[model samples]
Target: MLVSAAMLLTLGGCVTMSGDYNVTAVDANGQPIKMVMTSHGSAIYSSRNAFCSNFPKATVTIRDFHTGEELKSESPYHCR
Candidate 1:
């Protein structure tokens, strides 16, 4: 089980995001369900929007790691 989990994580990748920000998926009730610490670089988080579809009332929030600036928030992703 441990090996399979490791293999899956290796192949699946982390959080489906990459950038210098805190990316989080918030559920309808204003609870963070998924979050990832991205590497420092240009931002590209297109897949984060999918959480809205999957969770229906979910929101995807991207914030600057250093300054705490909110960089993004789309249609279905309204954060608390």
Candidate 2:
């Protein structure tokens, strides 16, 4: 039992999971302005809130982390 626990602990540290949806808000120059790794569109969804409302014109791009493809075309996040 002790050996099993130790082996599990050692391997657990090496295991990792990648998110299906990765979103980031970028400025006109394509510089990163914000990030949301947990779910799709969360970054754009929160743009109306206090934290993201500051960048009214930032472009939010959602991408497939496994494929490196844009889930959709970059769109401007309007605070209004």
Candidate 3:
């Protein structure tokens, strides 16, 4: 029983879940833009367009763990 309990604790600690983000931005039209995104615990999403119907015209970039990756993306062009 003790061994099982230890194994459960270890497994639970190893389990990591993704995070959620409610992102908002502004488009050229001056409107509010919102998107719901799901992160893979790595703090990286495939692309902004994947989450929302419209994507900002501003330069968008995504990086890996080794590289510096921006967690959130927003722009006036998107909300407007």
Q: Number of the top candidate by TM-score?
A: 1
lDDT of 2 by residue, 1-80 (tens): 99999999999777233446565676555577654543544443443243246555556655666787765434334333
Q: lDDT, candidate 1, residue 11?
A: 90
What is the Cα-based lDDT of residue 40 in candidate 1? Answer: 48
Off by over 4 Å in 2: 1-19, 28-30, 34-36, 40-52, 73-80
Q: Rate the local accuracy (lDDT) of all candidates.
A: 0.59, 0.54, 0.42
Model 1 quality (TM-score) = 0.47
75 Cα displacement, candidate 3 (Å):
9.4
Candidate 3 segments exceeding 4 Å error:
1-18, 38-44, 51-53, 58-80
**Which tens-of-lDDT digit does each residue in 3-78 have in candidate 3?**
9999999887663435443333444454544544434443433444553345444333332333334443322123
TM-score of every prediction relative to native:
0.47, 0.43, 0.28
What residue pairs are clashing in model 2? Answer: none
- Residue 33's C-alpha lDDT in candidate 1? 80
Total clashing pairs for each candidate: 1, 0, 12
What are the per-residue Cα lDDT tens digits for candidate 1 across 22-80? Answer: 65677888787855645344343444545555666667766777877777442234533
